[model samples]
Target: MNPLLRLLVLALVLPAAACSTLSAQQRDRAIAIAAAARAPAVDCGQPDRCAEPSPLRALAGEAFAASAAAPDGAPHHYALLLDEGGDALLARVNLIRSATRRIDLQTYIFDTDDSARLVLDELLAAARRGVRVRLLIDQLSAIADLQILAALSGAHQNLELRIYNPTFNLAKPNYLHYAASVVCCFRRFNQRMHNKLLVVDEAVGIAGGRNYQDDYYDWDAQFKFRDRDVLVAGPEVRTMERNFAAYWDDRRSVPVERLNDVARRLLADGVPAMPPARPAHPRRVEALSQAASDPETVRTQLVARAMPVAAVEYLADLPDKHHGDSALEDGVGAAGLAGLLAGAQEEVLLQTPYLVLSDHALEIFRGLRGREAPPQVRVSTNSLAATDNPIVYALTYKYKRRHVRELGFDLFEYKPFPADPPVDPALGGWWPGQAPADAPDPEVARSELPGGSLGGSRGSAGEAQVAAKLRTETRPSLLRTSAPANRPLPVTGAGPRMGLHAKSMVIDRRIAVVGTHNFDPRSETYNTEAAVVIDDPAFARALAASIEGDIAPGNSWVVAPRAKPPVLSGLNYSVGKVLERSPILDLWPWRYATNYEFQPGPECPRPLPRRDPEFHRCYAPVGDFPEVSLGPKSILTRMLTAFGAGLVPIL
Candidate 1:
């Protein structure tokens, strides 16, 4: 045998030979220790203070009351968009602090940064208050200290933690172990739990693209995520609760004690008190914590913004989505979006962090375009300059023709540093005239951006120039070298850049959907995703307005055909279209379309529609990639565009 072939066989066999699950005795010991430890009784005498101060609960009660009185029973929904980083963080904080009965959190990624630790500390406090708390985190991306996981396993009987789909039946697996597992069971190893959900007392639920990380909540100094979430309370919450239960009860969801790493520590040492979470951004955390618990802030800022609407539905794909090849199906997120787009009568708006589309999604667009009265479609996604995964962006870059001409899409790609991002009043924004109460600490108020830029919102022009020249900043990935196509993200800019991570759609200005699905091939085919659909015109319009802000001229770059090269314009487009149709061999440098920038002047104060005759007068072509340089990732992106089309389905 070849030396490499012989080594490959040994490598594949070693993981099975060396690895072990919880033995019979180990399992019995864990059960005994768990049985001996019981959670303390509730000590709280007042329920009101412990109650999360949300007017949505009252709205939900009124909905239920109306349902009982109606001729035909139908439920009502109270929902508000959590588009700002501060607001999303505040919702989670208040939810944890308010739990008197039970709290459940489900997310794909759980880091040990200041933001995640703060949430963990809050959950521990809730458990101490005798509120039952369960935390379900996917194994691949989550990083919990072994001692902490072991201590958490038995610290409070009221608090239970579980890991979903562990590759080696362990909380902490090394790179070699990860590689071996992939070679051994490729499909199962790739199956990740991508749902981001938080349900408090089964009365309120928050769902969207946020994971438990600093960037997701705008706490990261060097980078931040421009994401969105929906705080919902209605009959649909019951469905979310049931879906969480389904995941919790699934055999794939193993208790922390059952994991090899956590179990070993539990057997060696008795349960210890949870270590206090140390915050890197103490001033910011303190300010946010005050806002979350303050009656007036919760009442005025959050409660007042909620809209009471009718017909909200929660949809989730079960863990069986990865059982086998027989499990192949359009996950709920993909199917739900497809179904909603199919019903489009006049207009559709779609936004995602990733731009890669699955085949089913492509088919839906094709059918819609074939219609005699096809609806106008507008898409908002990350530009090469703004995306976390430039590799994925290459696939989108590979098919710009299909997205624009074939589908008739008015596509806008988000910028790395938008002039304005929707920020909470508690935190001032990029532009002036915001409420003056940003970070409480003057130095900290610069908000983690180096050289004192404010909260990664906006930076000096020179600072941005330096950042855009970045060639080697990497994205957050949990894989080793062997992982397919895993490479440092060609982040055009590094420090304090915000990327769009919200997955949402608005249809006909009458219905809206928000959830964790990226609408990319990975979310559509691989991950178990969930979403919320609301059929309320007013709420849909509000969601539409939020998306509108994102696609504004200063915030995004429009994707459109470049000015005809003045000669061979016909041959140029024809040849480019033919090359783009293939997944590979699309090496044409002068493509049909490129990103365009909006130049505002006194004559044109507002943005014009793409089809507007005067559109070209106000917009200037900004090249294929706006803020990017020819770096390694760019080279790889170029290479992938030319020859890597076959890697699309699993991106």
Candidate 2:
């Protein structure tokens, strides 16, 4: 059977399977239990009205107040979290452990993983200490973990949990049920809350792309993500707290106890015993403990270390962003970010796992390219080999070359682990920010390129022109080897492949935007997102340095014209070229592939190279297909994904 036809058949069949399954006894039992477990309403008023002085005020608050009161004080102070995964967890745990008044956390995915459990333990501990803990998680991913959530909410009178936009079908809240829900009610299920924020004591907050999950914090043995976040303090935190309050108060956010009787009954059963979380590295834990114990000293140290920012603003999408309301009126969605991007003067640095430029965004880029002094725009995103979402990759892959030649932006695709050696700590460490010593100088493109002349044709014509322009232009070569010039580099031992999951942008060394907003259609149209824009040259430069490190030759691959190989070489770069041109495959969202070598059921998986012990050389080139990690999806999931390929724009 044709592969395409098979995928279509699978998509249709899986939904039918979901409908046919009749766990009659289980469903009836669930209904009965839910009916009996109805929770009484508790009057938890507005978050702001409930606010109290942070205990830190008596301890750490003086230091922050002093910093803010200084005659030369900037509006905000920021610290960039360079630790790939561990440090982010440390920051959150420390904040929770030290909070005096309240803690508000809003996120898209709060998985029941080792890292998540550790954080949950801290929240529980904080609640025990009388700190108010409010957690708002998107229901899309949290539905399966209802029992755990119920237990958490029930364990502490000071803690409250809510799930956003929950589905009506509560018997089995797995992906199959969600898929069925989507099938039955596409519009509602299609929209999600994609916000990631953590604010403590209404004073300090952490925001970025990191979620509370194993993969997010580098606890997953199978995968790791190179991501970024910002530790922020000052008046801006109050604004972030209010944003959380708004979401918490939104009609879409339903308290977990209110998620129907069955869910409540399930919660009444108590959370199952989870395996002990892997202990955090001793140094990380020690740091967190010290910070938590001496909030004043830590605040002083943080203020001393923080980069002073001229201005800062928090932005968020409406909890009802799926309604497609104009962001300008509500100060949500991507309006603020879009406006910030449109004002770039010197350069724009974008780091996102996914890149699907909206029409407005494309126009912004086009205008920048058309400028007399066009800003040097550089974008670092996951290569086919490094992405976790092939469906989104398919959409962005089709526009890769056009973004390069037409938009005149330098594009770098992140390489999986072992492709690059261990990064130097001074340069950003494993998550390096300094460009490779041998990376093509950004100044070269800035100097040689004439104003609007570098721009190519738009759309398909623009894509066709890329090849010809690449052959003719004397511009700095965008195609370069992925390996770093430094040899026998320091290694972090062997582990799973590393992928880019950071969603950030630094513009003109004056503004930095970091949050859960991916530069994709889903973020722009279907889901709610949040980000903080700091208008500090120092902060922007710090972020840009990290971004620059990511785009360095050692960390990413430059997708350029394939080079001719020796006659004996049996390479197949042609496959990539063909895939780039094949409109049919591009049209079929689910018909995506990767180039990474897959060793299914291997007798012995490959080991790390002796010289490069930082990453295992687990994969080899597999033709020209682009590689992506979708985690451990079952047959039904694969089918749903394949079938839903055409829905990439909305998904």
Candidate 3:
């Protein structure tokens, strides 16, 4: 039997033995606790409440109504949100403040961070103004604070919060209980609502990869995600509203009042109501409020001045997609994405944080490559040094070479910190060709070598020699930057470490897709995903420009045909590569390894000072390597990964 399989078998059997040790009294107490945690269902009546008119409609609805009319005959209006963090936040807040009738929000993760609080405060404020608010969040990530959510919902009659596919046990949820719950309810626990969208007044919406968190918006001091989102106003907003209603009306979506009667009672017993924190960025709030005052100006500035309307299609998986239902019922699935890719005539650009290609995706790639006139295919994903999830990186690393060779796809791995100077806004920030001359070309092999030769398969003596040769090569050329010698360094210090979290695709410079779906098994089979596919050349080019900035040499590493050789300068890289090939050991503290890979070493250059404290760092360039580490918390994380690896197919 496989060692990993044997270990998993032992785990399943041993857990039962441990449970057998519990006395009858202890078992009863546990059952009582779980019973108390499970809340009774509350019926909110029909979904028609969401369509009611609001007082603000008279003030702010005219612009959206006009935009949706498309006097010029365009299908939709879109503005690419490239503000890193603040811009996206402001956009959502502004929409909420401007909304007159209803606001619908659906997200996978609604963190307790400042970003979430800011948005939540705005929602409460909107509700106070008599605008209806409906929020749908996945229960898996939101169950820990049921009392708080219940209190919030109870406080506002106009605002309703629903937890999608909630667990029966919600009180004081710990890791062990979570694991037990998963074991008992494996089917429901494995599936998540991995969708992020916000629609205002059923007239305009914002949808894309960003979640409600500081890191997504560039506010996290330690880490920042290079992400993307789109501001949409037009007929597509109505489609988004319909998607929200489907999830909101699903039987599995339990209202917070219904989730735990005990928690609801506790709230009635006078638990202190916790109001949202004061806005961290007060100026941002002021700006949004000012923009809300003039809906026409906001629309003109966001859409007319910058983005233009074009053909748009909203695509989303059904709330019941986890039930193994047919793709026809879901409306969105891997098949939709595959069909989109198949239609590419000249070029396909993809940006995803994770890239664990499925068999179906691989077959599509193979089909594309087999074509007599194959389009140029390029992919940008998180590098080992930049990925937040190391287990996913390990799996993706195993197939890196195959993706490049078999599919002829250009792959670029993002760098944690690039040393190039801040990009000129006029030239488009982080433009291509900002890295050293020696950076690998995705289309060219280092040598004319066949498969299984040097730089090919693992375990070959020739491959080892090739790795050694690569390690010995001079590093100066690879570290050179595009900045002039006389240019002064940033004064504020290095900015937050950057990672790729955006899920976007631009095909043939005429079609674009932006959403929360990562190109991995989890997204393909386990989680429900959402995105907007725009079929306009102008809109596609705008999105493509933002994606190209992320793939630029200064911001990302081009995956070479040869594996990046282990070097003393990148000790974490050596360890990560070794772990990637190991069976039991690879799971060792994957998160620690991921962190270690991106941690600065002795050779790392000092962060230049910048005048603005929020200014992002422009690092001195460096060579590529596998980023990894063994840290103090690795043991538990590694053990978790070991167990979780068994569920990778479903994950």
Candidate 4:
């Protein structure tokens, strides 16, 4: 054999040989770390305290809407909505540079994009600063980006990385699905660590929908998927700190040291040794000072914010109890949240990106509407026109008309953001107010009553409608004067303004819940999920108002329904009504895809092509969605199966 071939053979054989040899080493290392990181077992009796809080709560609150304030009256000041890629990256880098104590990160995907590299650079810097850095990522999601992980491993002794639920087949000619992964979907390769969180020094935290990816931060020129995240600094963050520790110490979360030489080499080459943190605003510290001041002042101003919930005594999902369970919760939180919605006496405003409600959810939504009828229940999500996930839209769209007519659940899809929103020229950036997290509200709202004005509502539509409505609206001059007539059309109506990626719902301004779960099938059935449901009336009202205000005409859009909604035939209307009533599809309609603009062109006047017709390549590659359908074959189904199977992970 050629020397290179000989080397390849050795490399192939080495993993298994090393695994056997390193078995004890890996176990000992994991055990040593686990032992040191063990959390104290404490009884949860006080409503405000728990035996332990997950480190994730730093970014996400221990209790929904819980204030970040600590007892010393030092307002727990944290930044939220770092929409700019540069700004977000700077925040993490600053935290790393500033850290004096510890660094903890947990993510579903800590990829190797510039953002991820930037984060890695910071993590290495923190480690060099003598900050203890612990990284926990899902075993499966990280496999594709193994080089980054390897890079981190090669250089940082102070840093300990763990892969949650690592696949056993890593080295062998193996074929067996880990039970956990199978239930959670392919991201898990069946299981997942779907949490997005970062806690530094147990003081500052970042959490929300944005993953550690380039697209997440608007670094890519291609269409950036709008998402949301919250930064926190408060006593509640300790809860998240604890969660990170818990997962970090879990025995099943294998130490990255266990990875084979090949994987390890890949990582080592992929990541360079730590670099010192560069200043976030090395030149412009003054601006950060101002942004930081706002959050700090706001926290202090809201003095009466509720304290943490009293601790409840319980085991933290003991493996023996509900071990390997498929559901996120046993239903207590779900039931409580539903009760909050059901108790709604008036209006209900929801902005969920993925709305796949189960029968139980539908019943809860229906009950809130007074069973088949009510004052009004409005929901804003991506139209097929706006949704990224067309299949999910297909599943959910089945219920649109029924929810509208029966429950009076009026549905509106986001229009695109306008070419211009009031820009902060000082920031040298267009705020674009609220763009779509795949859900853009119109620039203006039509009358609260449906057919109020085509003339009146031209600019009323938001970023979402701007793309499609420009061709149709009557006041071409107004739009032309205000923006190019070719600018995307604004949505019409008194309909609620939309948002990009806020999975929140407010019931008569009484309660709300926001978290990882979207209002769609992928969230409900496919992935492991978590959320915080807030019962505070004030918070709910504020949240609802904030959502509404963002999409409001001056900031967003409120458009009227089509003067003549493409009138459905009595038969189609009846079918829509029937489909809408179906529990499974009704709660999470899929029709939104019908509206997704498949073609990308200059803003235009007509509906986009139904299919790509030519399957235009995805302009922005989201690293390939992993293909899962590899096994089994019938001659006829083989090719079709292969093609379809390839898309399973992305879906």
Candidate 5:
């Protein structure tokens, strides 16, 4: 290591000596303080458990009972795709409410916002009613608010919470502590528990990309995630239980009382008595609560949507995903998706928010493309304007050529917001069963937003006119920004924006995969993740349809090769390829491909392939980054495209 770097590391690690780990005396005192706030046990008649009698719980019971007689390895499981955000949240709510014996939820981030608080309230209620509730959150992003972690320290005797892989054994690390942690224990700090799951009563569960935050469930007014999740019952739930237990019992999964920040809060303030939470949107909460409890509504929205499958295999990475001894295949989530794709006989439909691909992932695609009869590869990912992580989007931008020219990928970058922006600001309620009712028709309601045509995805001439309107509203100049990866170019609209966060795939339209694995290097090598792989053509088709909807011209932008410059097109291609192939920098101004809008007309009723002779005639080039300004983000993207390959493994 460099001498200055070594000295800096030493300086960072030294101050952590006084970190708030509990000594013997302090430990006892902390225990005493927390004991006072311990949840009162509710003794229900049945074996210290209060299992609910509801249609949701019954679905699991019936699934397990029916699965008992299935083949040893191929057991029956029912799966439901939660493409809509409201239904996704409603699923979690009903599953928790219906949980009889135990509820285990594992997530990457558990924010203290309304969405999280409402779910937290539910888990607390479940604990109070005598249902064992255990929540395990990744330490880095888990409960950043120290007070909430402190209160949760003694929230309930039945409700247990653990922070996974805490740096300096602290629940909420300060900026100083975080810097030192990255310097002193880089591997541990980088490898997080990216798993998102909710297993109830060891009978049913939800596994997918949603973290406990408003954005994931379309509740955030500023932004939302078009995320996906799979609700599974029967044999798959057993796998979820075991996977969660592995993380729960792992050494790195530290208890609340063991954390330094949480411990200090417990010692200084005693265990905090949690006040009754008042939801940010009471009507929204009430709507979901009523729908979750209503058997008819739950049945119609969830149970009816479920399709029985021959096999629903649950795959998850080991708790120590980045351990030195772990093999690449130890990432169960990655391996499952790989195996499914390897057998894609017809087409492969993949959707993920972060589109950066690891070398291993690129190699997989390469292998598929090398086949004599390669299947169609369709990818739906966030565009520059729609993405939450501008950094990751830059990486995706860096490799657009390889994805389109080499891999033959039908790349569809999701629009900022779609016609049906998951929450449906149209109806009275937002839940899949209950929706927002205060809106006029979608056309009128959408037009009221800053960039009303933003979600139209229609690729119409009117869209260009709206873009002109948006340009007038936005600041002409880019804001002065200095951050390398955090800088964001201004998107056209300022109103509520939506991004795609769903990580999913449909293979041969025969299998459906909905999981938290983004297939990036982090998911492939660093963080642990989990997913459900269901083998049912019906389910696969249903999943494909949902993804297809997201990629519709009105919902997304087609990424394709820009028509070769009329003159010296050949020379431009050669030079561009050389710059692209350069190991260090990809500075060629002209890119191989750009976003295209499908111009609908009497002559062109449907989409056309880029190879079609009349492709450019029907599809208009929309520049490299549409609805996005020329700014620091674009400059950084070019810089990273040249120098960011090394950052891929860690990022």
Candidate 6:
């Protein structure tokens, strides 16, 4: 290792020993925190052990929430839609800061940025207070930094860490990392734990798309998102906790201590002793407008109403209907509006960041468009300018104009928010779920329509005009800033351009299923996805209203010729559209594009492997694509990278 890198690792490994020169109050608080970590596990009836449900069992609306429950059972959970900014971010962060008894965190990706660090610090503080902290991060997404992990584990005896599907490289006949992943193909990659959850003291849970990253939390000053999350309590706590335990105990998970020496030391130090916690950051009730003054709606609406239900493990031998056994449910049909596209619904509104629609998805929408109601189907997504993944943009852009014209659905594309001029008076704070009257007139904001041409998807002139307005009216300029910017926003559009992350559809405010599943083929067929479909009109109405009133205007643009495709987004946008249109075409010659390949190993029934160079290249992208480093390769790194490649399929 380079001297600088070696020194850096050592610095992380050995931090300054706890300062002996501490104030008496500080010491007392620290000691008190230690005691709380030893409290007995909050029991929620041990989570419907040995029970399971069929994978084919579709839980429509009410049935989905039926599984949510608290240990004692009054539905104290809340299910408010998080389609706005500022308040929602604060609400979730506040919840994490206040968690006292135990914090169970799991995620596919956790970036090591300011927001991530801030939350990490909060977890550490809670751990010091005797709060038992157990964290499970997806090894595929979390680049293992042993030194950092070791230091963190060593700092708190109350914290337990584990990695889901880990890998490391090696040299010789085979890399150890490769071998690990090969074994995980069936047990790990096929069944990814894609759920992002934060459960605290059995009293609250936060489940949604937000990862532990600055961009996700809207902490980045340059660009921020208007995303959503459900802060749940009640019966749902039992279900989520049960789900968590299944993944926790799964054979694919490796206690992080096995890899980090410091983690081992911390575990050896033993659990701390501490007092039990009362509810912290409890839920609050109010009107949609009231959510502004009352931030507790997140907790009260989402977490407060959960009640327990049957527990289902990943590979448990449960009833065929609710079984969580296979990597993906094959052949069996999924319930809901599969072919219902033939029947007319008044309207269909679909928003997705990754839009890789399959034949089934296309047919459903088209069928709906042909119905008697001739429902006005409106689809919204980022213009080429806003897409984070250019390839995904390419895949979906191809159908923009065609869908709008042929399917008769209005298409809306988002343009960047305009720059606010210096000394502009409207530097006002926003209320949750309500657009301020002082804010721009909502009507004046145009509804974004798709571009005009069927084959050529480009923003309409109306879109260009609206884009200009956003730059001048809604967006604030980061350039000529008063302080150092974490990330600089584009000179045009509002702040930074953030992609649409909400994965849901509100059908006349009568039904909604909001979960972690994206509207892409990867999410549908390749990855394991979970969502809760809510049928209650009251709740669904609230969800729809939030999206329309709070989310639509500023974040999106209202364009004309809803028939046209949006503007050209460059290579990423073009290619992604082609891929999206061709479901069978999985491989392309792009460097970082997503590819669908057959799962590795003989366990999967498919075409047999061959060593032909052309054949291998085509399939290589499916499994462990090779990587060559720029710097001199070290023995450990080469091994670790090999290991990483082996596990790529599962990761």
Best by lDDT: 1
Distance (Å) between predicted and true CA of 398, model 2?
1.9
Reference-based TM-score of each model: 0.89, 0.68, 0.68, 0.58, 0.89, 0.54
Reference-based lDDT, each prediction: 0.75, 0.57, 0.58, 0.44, 0.74, 0.43
Better of 3 and 5 by TM-score: 5
Candidate 6 has a TM-score of: 0.54
Candidate 3 weakest ten by summed lDDT = 469-478
Compose the digit string of candidate 6's lDDT tens values, residues 1-651. 466865554454323212112445543443343334433433222232111121111111233454344354434334545543333444444555455456788776665555455456657666665667888876656523444554553456677667765543100111333333344333333444556777765655666666665445433433444456655544456666676776677665666544332233234453322222221111211121233223344334323333322321111110122234643244222223332223435655566655656656667776776666677666666544444443344444444434544566554444333111000011111211112222222122112222222111222322222222132111322111232121122233333334456666666555555556654545544454445455556776666654553223334443222111234435544564455345354232322221123233544333222222333333323211111111232232223322322222222
lDDT of 2 by residue, 10-110 (tens): 58646654453335565445434444433333333444332233333333354467566879864544455433464466557666766767889998777
**Candidate 5 global CA lDDT score:** 0.74
Candidate 1, 506-617: lDDT as tens digits: 9999999999876678887778898888999999999999998889887899998776653488887888889887875888777777888888899778788777888888
**Candidate 1 TM-score, C-alpha based:** 0.89
Per-residue lDDT of 445-504 in model 3, one digit per residue for the tens?
313222121122112112111111111111111111233211111111133445678899
Candidate 6, which ten residues in sequence have the lowest lDDT sum? Answer: 420-429
- Model 3 residue 107 lDDT score: 84
Each prediction's RMSD to truth: 4.5, 14.5, 14.7, 14.2, 5.0, 16.8
Q: List candidate 4 segments past 4 Å from native.
A: 1-90, 168-188, 260-322, 325-339, 371-376, 416-499, 510-512, 519-526, 532-542, 549-568, 577-651
Worst 10 residues of 4 by lDDT: 621-630
Q: Judging by TM-score, tell me the better candidate of 2 and 4.
A: 2
Candidate 2 accuracy as TM-score? 0.68
lDDT of 1 at 262: 70
> TM-score of predicted model 4?
0.58
Off by over 4 Å in 6: 1-76, 97-100, 169-192, 260-345, 418-495, 549-555, 558-651
